[model samples]
Target: MKNQTKMWLLIIISIFSSLIIFIAASFIMGDFGNKGYDIGDLKTISNEVLTTIDQQEKGISSILDAAHAEHPAVHFEWIQADGTAIYNTAGTPQNYDFQQLADHFLSIPYNLWTEGETISLVYKTHLQQQPYYLLMKLPSTAMQPGQVYFFLRTTKVLLTLLLPLIIAFMVPYLLAIWFFSRMNRRIHKLNHALTQVNLQKDIIVLQDTSKDEIGQLTQHYNSMVERIQSQVIEIEQFDNKRKQLLSNLSHDLRTPLTMILGYAETIRNGLYKDDRELQSSAKIILQRSRYMDKLLDQLLDITRQNTHALTLQLAPHNISEMLRKILADYLLFLDGQDYIVDVHIEDTDIMIHIDVALMERAIRNIIDNALRYGKEGHYLGIILKEQQNDVWITIKDKGPGIASAEQERIFERFYRVHQGRQGDGLGIGLSIVQEIVDLHQASIHVTSVPYEETLFQIRLPKKEDELN
Candidate 1:
């Protein structure tokens, strides 16, 4: 996968990991929460029932006392142990049969009726219709979970156990996510900008004003970018210097090779062979030798320009006037050439700051290449055009356009595409032009449509743009 895609995957995984930890912790702690204290409705109802039981026991005693004191004639009743009537206040024979009463009394448990202890019941038969109060022995058995009285409340305990754990885990997990979510988005924006930076495209810098770890990271990232830009500038300068040295050396070597070839070809063809012809050949040989010396000198000058501090002999001069004068000097050598030349500058006298001699050599090398290679009647022209704020001095040729794959390499030294021809070139002209353009802070771009049009478009800052 690409570096960009891998970075996004890491960021997404971080968020999910935080969420997963929260869920697992919540599940483990949920079992221990205490909710039973809040479900107290059953205790309230049991207390009210106990109060009713106490009132019923007291009312039973009041009725028993009334039967013994005043209802003696109405077949008054009395309870006794061992199946006997201890007292009958009524004159009539026993109203409740003793055998039937003792059996009925033994059936009702004593715990259901009284709190502590109970005496025998005293009630007349007419007054005892409201209740059959039991006079019996109490059993001492206790109640527990399995018996009918026990119903453990599980619902109340469960609710009390789970709520706070849900809250305890949820708040921190959400807080962590909310905190990181904003930082994550900013990092994503910065990642996009950094990827675009490698493509030589413009980037929008990330803005994070928060005082946090993410903010510090952004600041460091920006500082790293600044350092990288400085390093790139230094590396490019060294590269250009290296290419320049090779180009000059190759260009210098070409003259002697050209002479050597010309002499060998002339001797083979058996051209006129007098002492003057011999002298002419010798003269050409000597001239090429000296040309090598001048090439070395030019190479030294380029090295000086790059290594030492630059001292521009800045002056305001018209670009068109200078080009015309340089073209006039080249008229003798180019008089018989078949190439077409056109000049269409917007201003004849727009003064700008430049080193005039250096600028002329850069422009002249371009025209010289055109004359040498405008073979088989191909046309070459120079046009100067302007748009908005900049002026372009474009030199175009309809000769074989430089191939799409070879355009970038053209500015490198000693890199000859049209190989094995020494008089033709050593590939220094374009390299020199590129260096001068860099020094001037102007831009150069070469674009070509194969089998159609090839252009070397040089954009120069206008008079107003040049500040010395």
Candidate 2:
């Protein structure tokens, strides 16, 4: 639920609960206080007092003694018709004008008379046929009906006025503590998780089951951590690959550089026997220099691709024609290599969007790999065809094919297959091929069987409008 609605609900519940407790306590206390001092008990005592007066054969002295013994908390006074005090249960007898007092008591309203802290009830009884007034005074503090009624009324009024103020002040104060404490705990957990991430350089996911705002914050935090974790893993892998690339480049450059230097030195010092020998040394030096130049170029190309510095210039072109030209160039280069070039180009006008230069590079890398490694098999096959919405190009060679385990790693930078023909080229060609294909939103697959066929297939999505 929304926080505002939840707060309102809490306030309402607290108020009602407080009111219920107040009312229930008032009733319990009232009932407890009125246990033996209720109006009915008072009436019974008054009746007993009159009965003892009537049955007093010993006189007024005996009646007073009996009344005091029966009800110790009550004070009784006996007066004549003229308000002259005849006897008193309290120490000294006072000649109080009881008749005037009785007249004043009768004149006052019943509700107004019951507001006092004491209850004064005047009784008219005949003592030996003479009218006598008995004034019994009961302290309301002893749980008389007047005091209980007054207490209930007054307490109700004060509580009614104060309850809202009490709830207004206490509810927010109490709720502030409770709500903030709960919020603080959640925030503390998030802070702790962040601290752990900072300390360990690792991702920490929090478990938040609530649907509140705090829970949403937790979800966002977890998502951010996941992204950071993924980026961290990618960075570590990139660093390892970079180190590998540097190592491979140094090793590869050293060989060609060493060969070029030795050949150049031999020619420079006049170590050649004749013009033909000198020419051969120069040629060897030139070839090694070209190889080193090509290796450097490849390294730069792969680096550019990896760092997103290379962007594809996509245009619609007939891949079939592109493949034909590429194959023609390769066939010219493989003139006397004693290799069979099996080419099958499907005559379709299907056009696909691609970066011509990058796509050519990717296809050439696969075919070049096949030729370099599959020289012993003396076979190269290239096929281009349209299937459904995609154009598929398959290059197959009958060389010692890659193992299943090595096939997956073959596209990784500088990851060379050590078991087979051991081509002279560094292992970044296929890595560049994969990157180029991915940039075109295309897919590549490789499958090989030793001495049978090693196949590299490229699938490029055809332009939908052109296909239609």
Candidate 3:
């Protein structure tokens, strides 16, 4: 249930429970108040007073005194018909006329007057045939019949006004204690988890399965922790890759630089035997310089890709013709290299949007990787075909292919399949290939088996209108 609804329900239950307790307490108090005496005892006392008077065994004063002794909570008075007090337990003289008081008592039903703080019952009787008045005054607390009824009526009026007021104040107070206690517990858990996270620098998750507001807060907190952990891991991996890049660059550049320095020194010192040797040394120097320059260019390209600074000039081009041209260029370079170049290009009129320069660079990098690593197999296969709305370019080579474990990391900067192998070129070639393909919004995947066919496939979306 919703939090608001649950709060309201708690209030309602608290009020109901409070009412039940109040009513029960009121009943107990009422019953306790009425415990001492009742109308039956009063009637019995009055009858005994009459019998004593009729027997003439004792005077009216003596009789009243005896009754007073029997029920001390009651006040007894004997008055003549003329309002003269003949016997009185209280010494105070009557301020009002006895006849009026008697008349008031007689006017009430059952000749019993119950009001205010006291209950007065008047009895008319004859002593020696002479009319006298016997007044029995019982305090309201004595639990006389009329007094009980009066107290209950007054209590009803008081409770009617007071009970709702009490319930109204009590319910929210109780609800506040309950709500705060509940919230404090959940907040404490959250705080404790946060403390652990801060101290340990590790993920700390709270176990809260409730679907309340606090539960949702907990879920969001857990999600945030997960994101933080993932970012931390990503940062560590990036740092490692950066260190690897610097190490590889230092080694690769040093070798070419050292060669160029040595060759220049040899020519400068006139250590060469003839013009042919001098020309060979100059040429070697030039080749090494070009290789170092190419490595530096690759590094710049990767940096631009990482910073999202590389822009693509997109235009639709025939993928079949593009693949054939790339293949012809590679074949010219391959010339007499003992490698089988199997080419299959399905002539398709459809074109795909691409950055021609970046795409060719990507394709050339893949073919170069194959030629370098797959030299032992001496076999290279290139295929271009259209399948549905996508153009697939598959470049397969029979070489000691990548391991399943290393395939995922092959595209990472400076990650080489054959580590510590000199002249393998910086391993950023395939990484740059991946970045270019991603810019074109295409996908690339590689599948390989040891010394078997290693296929690199690039899938590019066919032109939208052509697909339609």
Candidate 4:
């Protein structure tokens, strides 16, 4: 669920980033386009104004001829066309080049431009909108003929360009907002799922079962939840077994000790004084006392592992040298027995952090278990291998392999896998081996295949941190 939320967030942010780039670029391009059109309109209107004025030449001639015929001696003339002007409402001629003024005026509808020498304010309502300027050339006989003609207008050009620019701004802006909202909705849904996950509560099953990438991700998350549920169930089962084993321990050993204590009190303090009676009572007392001592010792070693009395002093030491010394110590005790001990080890530098005495006791118990439970003529084998960062030790034998159902409980205290072969000592040897390995955080595994081999393997990490 957390993963899904992160994916949706990334997608949403990417879409928003693209939308911002698209809108910015579109705005710039639209403005540039409008600017180009405005420049063209100015130039085209300049040419049209010139045409309007040139068509007036014949009219100007008719008016000038009538004035000259009426007053024959009046002197008047028009010559070299320099420029023009148009007057505002304030009766001032618009200043600048004649062509520029003509372009500015010609853009207005129903407006006319003509070359003239006089400045005057003219109102023409025939234009679609009242223009900023309207210019006309005076007759050749008019006053101030020294001035050329010019005109100016701005209203029509602005209205022509305004509508399209507004459309350009709105269309893509609306679409970008629409796309961003869509991606935001997807991300919000995914975030809700992750909120449930962070609280360590049950997940809400997403109902959007569409066949897209989101659907695939939802399916994977559901599978992870199922696997986690199964592991939790396994842990509960182990906890229940641990409780059952503790209950069994109290029942099994207390019953035998009660009888042994009762009988010992009867013989002590002159209760059995005859020679034959004394001898038999002494033997019974000695045997029962030894049995009780062994049971108490086994329980005490594991239960108070941190007590100063039981805790072994740990030090750094070479593992190969220690194992060789342990092997020599075991050899003299098994001199007469036909059982063979095969040791396979590498001649490499493998050092470890451990209590030498406790380690020796742990390995001896494993060897004893093999010898006591193995089938006819099967020898015990110990193989040790080391890599740069770890060591693996394997103990194998052709024992009557433990049943599949008993493999897990076989490591519990007093769990006897083979009932017929359980007479030598309490069934806590493998338990001790497991406890020691657990104390060091090393790993242990057991596997038994029918009629082939039974193996106990231990894996220990390489000692890397030096004692400081």
Give each model's whole-structure lDDT: 0.58, 0.78, 0.80, 0.59
Clashing residue pairs in candidate 1 are: 33-161, 35-160
Kindly provide the TM-score of model 3 when superposed on the true structure, using C-alpha atoms: 0.65
Which prediction has the highest TM-score against the true structure?
3
Candidate 2 or 4, higher lDDT? Answer: 2
For model 4, what is the C-alpha lDDT against the true structure? 0.59
Off by over 4 Å in 2: 1-176, 347-350, 419-426, 464-468
Query: Any runs in candidate 3 off by more than 4 Å, and if so which?
Result: 1-175, 195-200, 347-350, 465-468
Any runs in candidate 1 off by more than 4 Å, and if so which?
1-272, 308-310, 345-348, 373-378, 386-388, 413-428, 450-452, 465-468
Which run of 10 residues does model 3 get worst, by summed lDDT?
A: 144-153
Clashing pairs in 3: none
In model 1, what lDDT does residue 216 have? 86
* Candidate 4 displacement at residue 142 in angstroms: 26
What shift in Å separates residue 433 of candidate 1 from its native position after superposition?
A: 2.0
RMSD of each: 15.9, 12.5, 11.7, 13.2
Worst 10 residues of 2 by lDDT: 107-116
Instruction: Rank candidates, TM-score, best first.
Output: 3, 2, 4, 1
Question: Clashing residue pairs in candidate 2, if any?
Answer: none
If both were scored by TM-score, which would come out higher, candidate 1 or candidate 4?
4
Candidate 1 lDDT by residue in tens digits, 1-468: 854455556556755775687777765554344212111322342233334434564443344345335422122233433334434333332445666665544533343233443223222221223333222221112111121132448878766666776677567656756655655677777777677675254444667777787788878777777777777776777677567546546655865868767976786687847879877876776777666765665566556545753445556678778866766776665577754556566654666677787677778877766656644335666776665667677877777777888888887654555764544444556777777777777888988765456778778776645633
When 2 and 4 are scored with TM-score, the better candidate is 2
Candidate 4 residues 169-206, lDDT tens each? 56765676666576556657766775676324555655
TM-score of each: 0.43, 0.63, 0.65, 0.44
